[model samples]
Structure formats: structure tokens, C-alpha cells
Target: MLGQERSRSFTATAILFLLPAVAFYVVYMLLPIPMSFYYSLFKWDGISPTKVYSGLSNWDEMLHDTIFWGALRNNIVLVVLSILIQLPIGLILGVLLTSRIRFVKLFKTVYFIPMLLSSVAIGLLWKYIYDPTFGLLNSFLRLIGLQHLTTGWLGDPATALFSVIGTICWQYIPFYMILFMAAIVGIPDELYEAAKIDGASDLGCFRHVTLPLLRGTISMASILSLVGSLKYFDLIYVMTEGGPNHSTELMATYMYKKAFHSFEMGYGSAVAVAMFAISLIAAVAVMGVTQYDARAL
Candidate 1:
């Protein structure tokens, strides 16, 4: 009886200690979520008290909204591109740098410089680099006598989407590269030694040993990349603001445009909710698969 009373007393004390954090999460995260849902049911310009609760009208519009569809498609493209290009490329760089190379630490710092900067700065810097009129890319193309390749990257509809993807890749690849390097360092040297003793080639040893051991880390990095891409806004906003016929519009940017620019607060809230739902689902799916794989092992 005494032990039970003490345990209950300790539990109450722990709850008291956790109260501030719990309150913070509720106020900052949880409350806004439901409030956003409520806002999604109304029709308001965000400044007036004349909100009309139109039931599912806002959600209905979002369902058939072409811009919303475009935003969703762009987000999907970003996720696919980040995983397909950024992660593999970063892993390759990590593998090479972890080898018997010179100035690996220097190279790492240089590579990660862009990622360390503000997204706005990175986007603006890349925009200038990709500028057609006086940009380095155009200058290089002209110098190589490939003047025909010079075109306004963000201005043209054809290349705008891809240009944004490239910018994101440049800023993100170094992050994954560092992650992969850490994971590679954590691997046991005995595995590689045993593989070499068994007459395994370098490529074969990497395929059998390095990759298998780095599985957990790669999965974690991939999941993070995917989630980040899904909620992406700042860089795209800084560079293009979904310009050139809204080619680079992502869900997050789209939601912001709808709420503030278009003054469709309710509809924008619906978009935000949809975004939250999509990210939540993707995170859960990735985490669930990773957990299952671990349990199987």
C-alpha cells in the first residue's frame, strides 16, 4: 500500500515537471491544428468577422482545384527527385570521401557551406548562378561555344521546374553526404577485412558489407529527405514564388499564396490541413516500414 502511494506520488510529480512542455506543444502545435480545421469550414478574407461556415464547401473546392492539384504534383515530384537524385549522389560522394582521399575534412566543410546558409540566401545565390543574361552558367556555356544552351532558367516554363529541383538538390545533398559518412565510420573494420580475405573485390565488398550495414542510416536519411521535400516552401518561395506559370509551386507555398495572396483563408486552411495529412501519412509509412524491418532482423 505504501509503495503504491509512493509510485502515484512520483507519477504526479513527473506530470508536474512535464506540464510546461505539454502546454507548449498543445498551444503551438495541437491547438493550431484544430483551429485550422475550423477555419477551413468558413469563407473569410481573414480580416473580417463576416466568416460564413460553408460546411464542406472549402474542402470541395480544394478537391477540384487545379492549382491545388498542381501544388500536390509538384510536391510529389520534389519527393521523388530528392530520393532518386540527392540521396544516391550524396551516398556516392560519402563513399568516395571516406576512402584514402586528401583533405576530406576541408572538402566536407566546403560542400556543406550552402546547406549551412539560410534557404533564402541559397536560393538567391543559385538563382544568380542560373541567370541567363549575366549568370556564370550562361557565361560558361558561351565560353564553351554552346551559346545556344543559354536561356532564362526560371523564366521559361520548360526548364523552370527542373531548375528548382536542381537548386534543392545542391543545398540538400551535402547534408545526406555527412550523414552517410558518419554511418560509414560507425561500420566495423573487421567486416571489410574479412571480405578482402575472402577474395572480394572493392565493389563486391561495398555491395555486400558497407551497404548492408548502412541500411538503417540510409533509410533514416531517405525518410527525412522525403518528409522535408513534402513540406518545402522557403527556398522555392525565395527563388520563384511559383512563377513562370506556377511551375515550381509546392503545397506549402501554394497554401501561403491562397491564404494571404488570394484572401481565401478558409480554402487555404483546407490546403494546410491536406498538407499536414499527407506529411503525417508519409512519416508514418516510413517509420512503420523501418520498424518492421528492424523487427524482422
Candidate 2:
């Protein structure tokens, strides 16, 4: 009888601990997600006094909308580029900093500053850097007698999308850097010492010891980067706004355009749904990959 009373007390305490957080989530994030679903069935400007229900009509239009596809393709590009470029570079930098390299703190801080800055600030900063007219990049290229390498990075259609991608990658690299650095630092020094006693070269030690142990951390980083890229909007929207012929339109940007710019609230909701679906798919894929790799190890 006493034990049963104690169990009840424990359960009540746990409920008390969880209630505030659950309430906050439901009030803020969770409720809004379902609200989007309900709003998706109605055709009305957000300010309209009358909402006309058009079940599945908006989704049907979205299925054939070319712009949605472009945005989705751009998102896919960001996702691929993020994983391919950011992950390896951040991992390598993390490994170097965590090693017996000189002035590790200084280097880590320098790399992390970009991440600490606002995304808007980073976007504006990169815009000037990529400017063709009297910009630092062009000036440096001319100084080095590589003047032909200069191009209007954010303006040229051929390069605009890539330029935005680069900015996103640059701003985000430090986050992955810090994540990898933490994982690498948590590894015991004895592992490296044992590898050295076995006469393992630096590369061999990294491959054998560092990579395997860092698997969990890498998986986590990959998931974050993938999800962030899937829903990416701020940098691209600020820098290009899908300009130079919509070369950089991402799914989130497209949703914004439909919702506010075009005043098609229902269709915008549909786009939002699609964006949600795409993000969910990408997240699931990364999870699957991480699980498979973890099991193989």
C-alpha cells in the first residue's frame, strides 16, 4: 500500500514537471502545425472575412505548379551541397583544431564568429564580398593577376544560386565545427596514445580511431544540416530572392510568395504542406542513413 502511494506520487511529480513544456509546445508550435492543415482547405486571403472551402483543390494546383518544383529542386541542391561541402570541411577543421595545432582557441573562435552573427548580416556581408564592382573578391583577383576569374557572384544567373549556397555553407560551417570539436575532444587521450604505440600514422589513426568513434556525432550533425537546408530561406531570400530568373528560389521562399506576395492563402497553405512533406522526407532519409551506418559499425 505504501509502495503504491509512492508510485502515484512519482507519477504526479513527473506530470507536474512535463506540463509546462507540453503546454508551451501545444500553444506555440504544435497547434500551428495542425492549423496549417485546416487552413489549407480554404480559399481566402488571410484577411478575408469569408473563407470558401475548396477541399484538396489547392494541393491539386500545387501538384502541377512549376514554381513549386523549382523551389524543391533548389532545396535539394542546398541539401546536397550542404552535406557534401559543409560536413567534410567542418569535420576536417575540427580534427585539426582538436589536434596539437597551435593557438587552437584563436582558430576556433575565428571560425565560430560567422555562426554567432545574424543570418541577415552574413547574407549582406557575403553580398558585398561577391560584388563584381570594386568588391574585395574582384579586387583580390585583379591583384593576383587572376582578373578573368572575377564574376558578379550574386547577379549572374550562372553563379547566383551557387553564390547563395556558398554563403549558407560559410555561415553554417562553424556550427558543425563546434559540434565536431566537442565530439573529438570528448574522446580520451589514451585512444590516440594506444594507436601511436601500434605505429599508426596520423591518417591511419584518424580513419581507425577518430572516424569510428565520431560516428554518432557526425550522424547528428548530418541530420541538423540536412533539415536546416531543406527549409532554408532567409539567406537565399535576402541575397537573391530567387532573382536572375528564379535561379535560387527555395521551397520556403516559394511558400512565402504564394502566401503573402500573391495573396493566395489556400495555395500558399498547400505550398507550406509540400514544404513540410519535403522536409519530413529529407529528415527521414538522414535518419535512415544514420541508423544504417550505425548498425554497420
Candidate 3:
């Protein structure tokens, strides 16, 4: 009877400790989802005194919206490119940093400098670099007698999306690099020592030992990159505002324009909800696949 009473007391204390976090999650995360969905079913300007029930009109309009589809396509491209570019480069950098290289500390600091800056700051800095007239990129191109290659990077529709993507990759590569470095640090050195005893080359050790062990980390990084790419906005917004014929438009940027800029709150809410749904689905799919792979292994 005394033990039962103590168990009850302990459970009560645990509940008390968890209540705040549960409440926060409900208020900030859970509540907003349903609220956004509710708002999406209406035609409100967000400043109006009345909300007209549109009943899925916004979703219908979104389905037929060309720009919405384009933005989604851009997001998909970003996800693919982010995974393809960031992971390999980050992995290489991680390996290099972990090796017995000179100036290792200095190189790590220099590589991580971009991650230290605010997204808006990076955006503005890159915008200046990509400037057409007297900008670093164009000036260098002219100096190299590649004058034909010098064009407005952000202002040209053809290059705007790619230029913005390159900047996004540059800013985020360091984050993945750090992640990979930490994962690499956690790897058991004994495994490498064993491989060496078996006459394994450095490349062979990496291919057989490192790659297989880092699968989980790679999977997690892929999911992070996927979700982040889907919801990306700030840097692109600061740099181009989805300009140059809407070539650089992302779902987040488009949603912001509709809600705040165009004052189409309902449509914006629909877009936001759609983004949430897509992200949730993609995350779940990746997680499931990773779990299946783990089980197989």
C-alpha cells in the first residue's frame, strides 16, 4: 500500500512536469493547424469584420493555379538538389576535418562562417555579389574576358532561380557539414583500426565501414533537408522577392505574398495548409523508408 501511494505521487510529479510542454505544443502547433484549415474554408481579407464561407473554393483555386504548381516544382527541385549537393560535400568536408590536416581549426571556422550569419544578411550580401553593374561576379567575369557570361544574375529569369538556389546551398552546406562531423566523431575508431589490420585501404575502409554506419545520419539529414526545402522562404524573399517573372517563387514566398501582400488571407491559409500537408506526407514517407531500411540492415 505504501509503494502504491509512492508510485501515484511519482506519476503526479511527472504529469506536472509535462503539462507545460504539452500545453505549449497544443497552443502553438496543434491549434494553428486546425485554425489555418478553418481560415482556408473562408474568404476573409484578414482585416475584415466578416468571413464569408467559401467552402473549399480556395483549395479548388489553388489546384488550378499555375503559379502554385510552379512554386511546388521549385520546392521539389530544391529538395533534390539540396540532398544531392549538400550531403556529399558535407560528408567530404567532415572526413577532411576529421583527418590529420594542417590548419584544421582555421578551415572549420572559415567553412562555418556562413552558418553564423543571419539568413537576411546572407541574402543581402549575395544580392550585392550577384549585382549586374560593378558587382564582384560580373567584374571578375569581365576581368577574365568572359564578358559574354556576365548578365544580371537575379534580374534575369533564366538565372534567377538557379542563382537563388546556389545561395541557399552555400548558406546551408555548413549546417550539414557540422552534422556530418558530429556523426563522424561518434564513429568507433576501432572499426577503422580493424579494417587497416585486414589490409584495407583508406578508401575501402570508408566505403565498407564508414558509409554503412552513417546510413542513419544520412537518412536523418535527408529528411531535414527535405522539410527545410519545402518551407524555405526568408533568404529568397530578401534577395529576389520571387521576382524576374516569378521564376524564383517558392510556396512560402507565394503564401506570404497572398496573405500579407495581396491581402488574400483565405487563399494564403489554403496555401499554408497545403504546404503543411505536403511536408507531413514527405516526412512520414522518408521516415518509413528509413525505418524499413534499418530493419533490412
Candidate 4:
């Protein structure tokens, strides 16, 4: 009886400690989801006195919206490019930084500068770099007699999305590099020593030992890249506002434009709900695949 009473007391204390965080999560995270869905079923301007019930019309409209499809395609491209470009480059930098190279500290500081800047600042800086008239990129092209190659980088539909994507990758690569660096640091030196003693070359040791050990970190990074790409906004919005014929449109940017800019709150809510669903599905799929691969190994 005494032990049962003590256990109850401990459980009560634990609940007391967790109450604030649980309350915050429910209020900020869980509540917003259902509210978004509710708003999605109405045609309200977000400031009006009355909300007209639109039922499933918003969802139906989304299904037929070509722009939404384009934005989703862009999001997918971002996800693929982010994983393909960021992970390998970050891994290389991580390996380089962790190795006994000269001026390692300086190199690290230089590489991490992009991650330190705000998205808006980086966007503005790169916008000038891509400017058609007297921009750094065009000036360099002319200096090298490659004037034909110089054009409005962010203004061209063919290049706008790719240009923005490149900037995004540059800004984020350092973050993944740091993540990889930490994971590499946690690896036991004994494993590499044993591989070396077994006549393994640096490349061979990395392929056999390092790659296998860093699988979990790689999987986690891939998931992070995936989700982040899906919900990406700010920088792209600042750079292009999904312009040049909406070539750089992303789901988040489109949603913001619909809700706040265009004042189509209901449609924006629908887009938001779609984004949430897609992100949740993608994250679940990635986690499931990673778990399956782990179990298979």
C-alpha cells in the first residue's frame, strides 16, 4: 500500500513537470491543425464578420489548380536537389574539416558564414549578384569574354528556379556539414585503426568503415532536407515572389500569397492543409524506409 502511494506521488510529480510543455504543444501545434481544416471549409477573407461555408469546394479547386501542381513539382525538385547536392558536398567538407588540414579553423569559419546570415539578407545579397545590369556574375562573364552566357539570372523563367535553388543549397550546406562533422567525431578511432592495420587505404577505410557507421546520420539528414524543402519559403519569396511566370513557386510561398496577399483565406487554409498532409506523408515514408533498411541490416 505504501509503495503504491509513493508511485502515485511520483507520477503526479512527473505530470506536474510535463504540464506546461504539454499545454504549449496542444495549444500551439495540435489546435492549429483542426482550426486550419475548419477554416479550409469556409470562404472568409480572414477579417470579415461572416464566414461563408464552402464545404469541399476548396479541396476540389485545389485538385484542379495547375499552379498548385507546379508548386508541388518545384518542391519535389528542391527535395531531390537538396539531398543530392547538400549531403555529398557536406560529407566532403565534413571529412576535410575533420582531417589534419592546415587552416582548418579558418576554413570552417568561412564555410559556416552562410548559415549565420538571415534568409532575407542572403536573398537580397544574391539578388544583386544575379542582377542583369552590372551584377557581379554578368561582369565576370563579360571579363572572361563569355558575354553570351550572361543574362538575367533570376529574371529568366528557365533559370529562376534553379538560381534560387542554388542559393538555398549554399545557405544550408554548412548546416549539414556540421551535422556530419559531429557524427564523424563520434565514430571510434579504433575502427579506423583496425582498418588501416588490415592494409586498407584511406578510400577503402572510408568506404568500408565510415560509410557504414554514418548511415543513421545520413538517414536523419535526408529526412530533415526532405521536410525543409517541402515547407521552404522566406528566401525564395524575397528573391522572386514566385515570379517570372510563377516559375519559382513553392507551396509555402503560394499559401502565403493566397492568404495574406490575395486575401483568399479559405483557399490559403486549404493549401496549408495540403502542405501539412504532404509533409506528414513524406516524413512518415522516409522514416519507414529508414527503419526497414535498419532492420534489414
Candidate 5:
């Protein structure tokens, strides 16, 4: 009975220690979610003293909104590109940096510079670079007798989405690279030495040893990239404003338009709820797929 009392006392102390954090989460994160769901069922202009109960009408409208679907498709495209392009390139850069290359520190710093800059700053800088007439890209093309190749990159609907995607990749690849570099650093040199003694080439060592060890980090980076892509807003918003004909529109931008610009608070809340739902679903899906990959490895 004395030991049981002590155990109960320890549990009480632990709960006391956790109380503040739990309270903060309840107030900030947990409360807002259900509130958002509640708001989604009403038609309110956000400033009106009254809210009209709209039931499932907002959600039903969203189902038929073609623009919303387009934005969703764009978000999916971003997720795919992030997985296929950014992750592989990041892994390659991490491997190269960890190798015995000269000027390793310099290379690392240069590679990481993009990740350090503010997203808004990077977006503005690239906007100038993609300028059609006087932009750096067009100017360079004209200088090299490739004037015909120079076009309005951000203005053209065909190129606007991809142009924004490229910028996103440039800004985020370094983040994954850093994650990979840290993981690579944790690996033991003794393993590589053993592989070498066994007459394994560098490629063989990487394929058989390094890849397996980095599986956990790879899974983490993939999930981060997936979720980040889904909620991607700032850079694309600043760069394109979903521009040139909704070509670069993303789900987040669409939500902003509905809530703030259009003053459809209820509809916007519905969009927010959907956005949250999609993000959660995608995250769970990625976790499951990566878990499977981990098991297979």
C-alpha cells in the first residue's frame, strides 16, 4: 500500500508538470479545429452579428467547385514533384557533401543559402529573374542568340505552374539536404571501412550499406515534403497570386480567396476544414507507405 501511494504521488506530479502544455494545446490547437468545423456549417460574413445556418450547403458547393479541384490537382502535382525530384537531389547532395571533397564547408554553405532566405524574399527575387522583357532569364537568352526561347515565364499559363514549382524546389531542397546530411553524419565510418575491405565499390557501399541505414531519415523527409507541399502557400502566393488565369492556384490560395477576398466566411471555413482533412489524409497515407517501405527494407 505504501508503494502504491508513492506511485500515485509520482503520477500526480507528472500530470502537474504537463498541465501547462496540455492547457495551451487545448486552447490553441484542439479548440480551433472543432470551432472551424462549427463555422463551416454557417453562412456568415465574419462581421455580421448573425450567422445563418447553412447545414451542408457550403460543403455541397465545394464539391462542385471546379477551381477548387484544379487547385487540389496542382497541390498533388507539387507533392509528387517534391517526392521524385527534391528528395533524390537532396540525397545526392548530402552524399556529395559527406564525401572527402575539397572546399566541403564552402559547398555546404552555398547550398544552404537558399534555405536561409525568407520565402517572400526568394519569391520576389525569382519574379525578377523570370521577367519576360528585361528579366535576367530573357536577357541571358537574348545575349546568347537564343532570343526565340525567351518568353513570359510567369505570364504564360502553360509555364506559370511549373515556374512556381521550380522556385518551390529551389527553396526547399536544401532543407531535405540538411536532414540527410545530419543522418549521414550519424552513420559509423567503421561500416564503410568494412565494406571497403570486402572489395565493395563506392556505389556498392552506398546501395548495400548507406541506403539501408538512412531509411528512417528518408521516411521523415518524405513526410515533411508531402505535408509541406500540400499546404504550400506563401511563395506561390507571393510569386503568382495563383496568377495569369488560376494557373498557379493552390488549395491554400483558394481558401484565402474564399474567406478574405470574397467575404464568404462560411464557405472559407468549409474550405479550411477540407484543407485540414486533406492534409491529415495525405499525412496518414504517406506514413503508411513509408512504414511499408521500412518493413520491406
Candidate 6:
């Protein structure tokens, strides 16, 4: 009876400790999701208390909106490029840093510096770097006598999306690098030694042992990349405001424009809800595929 009482007391203390965080999450996160879903079914300018029931009209409109589709496509482009380019680069860098490389600490710090900067700041910095008139990029091109290649990067529709994506990769690659590095460091050295004893080359050990061990971290990084790409807003907003004819507009930026700029709160809520659905779907799909792959392996 005494032992049972002590167990109950411990359980009560644990619940008491968790209550504050759970309350905050319910107040700020959980409640807002349902509220957004409810708002999505109404037509309101946000100022009027009268919410006209529109049913699925907002969703219907979003489905037909070409601009919204374009923004979504741009988001997908970011996700694809991040998975293909960013992850590989980060993985390579992580491997190199973990190997018998010189100045490992210095290299890690330098690589991680970009991730420390605010997205807005990084956007502004890259904006200047890509500037056509008297910008570093154009100036360098001119110096190298490639003046023909120098054009307004951000202002040009052909290059705006790619330029912004490059900035996004630069800002985020370090994050994946650090993530991968941590996972790589945690791997048992005994595995590597065993591979070496079996006459496995460096590449062989990495291909067979390291890559398999890092599968979980890779899946995590992939999910994070996908979700973040879908909701990407700050840097793009600060850099272009989805400008140059909406070439770089993301779903989040479009939602903001509808909600605050255009005063279409209901429409914005619908977009937000749609984004939430898409994020959940993408995360689940990626996780499912990774799990299947792991099982197959």
C-alpha cells in the first residue's frame, strides 16, 4: 500500500510538471488549428463580426487559382532542390569534417555561421550579392569579361526563383550538415574498425556502414526540408515579396497577402488549412517511404 501511494505521488508530480507546457500548447497551437478550420468555412473580412457561411467556396476558389498553384509549384521546386542538392552537400561536408581532416573545428564553425543568421538578414545579404547594378556578382563577371552574362538576377523572371532557391540552400545547408555530423559522430567506431579488418576501403565502409546507420537522420532531415520548404516565407517575402510576377511566391506568403493585405481572412484561413493538410500529407508520405525502404534493406 505504501509503494502504491509513492507511485501515485510520483505520477501526480510528473503531471503537475507537464501541465503548464500542455496548457500553453492547447491555448496557442491546438485551439488555433480548429479555429482556423472553422474560419475556413466562412466569408469574413476579419473586421466584421458577421461571418457569412460560404461552405467550400474558398477551397473551390483555391483549387482553381493559377497563382496559388504556381506558388505551390515553387514550394515543390524548393523541396526537390533541397533534397537533391542540399542534403548531398551537407552529407559530404559532414563526412569530410568527421574524417581525419585538418582544422575540423574551424571548418564546422565557418560552415555553421550561415545557419546562425536570420532568414531575413540572409535574404537581404544575398539580394545585394545578386544585384545587377554594381553588385558583387555582376562586378565579378565584368572583371572576368563575362559581361554578357551579367543581368538583373532577382528582377528577371527566368532567374529569380533559382536565385532565391540558392539563397535558401546556402542558409539551410549548414543545418543539415550539423544534424548529419551529430549523427555521424554518435556512430560506433567499432563498426568502422570491423569494416577495415574485412579489407573494406574508405568508400566501401561509408557506402555500406555509415550510410545505413545515418538512414534515420536522413529521413528526419528530409522531412524537415519538405515541411520547411512548403511553409517558406520570411526570406522570400523580405527579398522579393513573391515579386517579379509571382515567380518566387510561396503558400505562406500568399496566405499572408490574403489575410492581411487583401483582408480576405476566410480565404486566407482556407489556404492555411490547405497548407496544414499538405504538410501533414507530405510528412507522412516521406516517413512511410523511408520506413518501407528501411524494412527492405
TM-score per prediction, in order, is 0.93, 0.90, 0.92, 0.92, 0.90, 0.90
Instruction: Give the better candidate number (1 or 3) by lDDT.
Output: 3
User: Per-residue lDDT of 72-147 in model 5, one digit per residue for the tens?
Assistant: 9999999998889899999999999999999999999999999889989999999999999779989999999998
Better structure of 4 and 6 per TM-score = 4
User: Which regions of candidate 5 deviate over 4 angstroms?
Assistant: 1-20
- Error of model 4, residue 277, in angstroms: 0.5
Would you list the C-alpha lDDT of every candidate in the order shown?
A: 0.91, 0.88, 0.94, 0.95, 0.92, 0.92
Identify the superior model by TM-score, candidate 3 or candidate 6.
3
Model 2 spans > 4 angstroms off? 1-20
Better of 1 and 6 by lDDT: 6
lDDT of 6: 0.92
Q: Model 3: runs farther than 4 Å from truth?
A: 1-19, 197-199
| Candidate 3 total steric clashes | 0
Model 6 alpha-carbon miss at residue 57, Å: 1.5
> What is candidate 3's TM-score against the reference?
0.92
For residues 1-297, what per-residue lDDT tens digits would candidate 1 score against the true structure? 569889999999999999999999999999999999999999999999799989999999999988889989989999998999998999998898899889988888798887789999989998899888889889999999999989999889889989999999999999999899989988889999999999999999889999988888888888999899999999999999998788888899989999999899999999999999999999999899999987776
Q: How well does candidate 2 match the true structure in TM-score terms?
A: 0.90
Best by lDDT: 4
Tens-digit lDDT track of model 3 for 172-211: 9999889989998998999999999999998999899888
Q: Write the per-residue lDDT of candidate 4 for residues 21-56, one digit (tens) a residue.
A: 999999999999999999999999999899999999
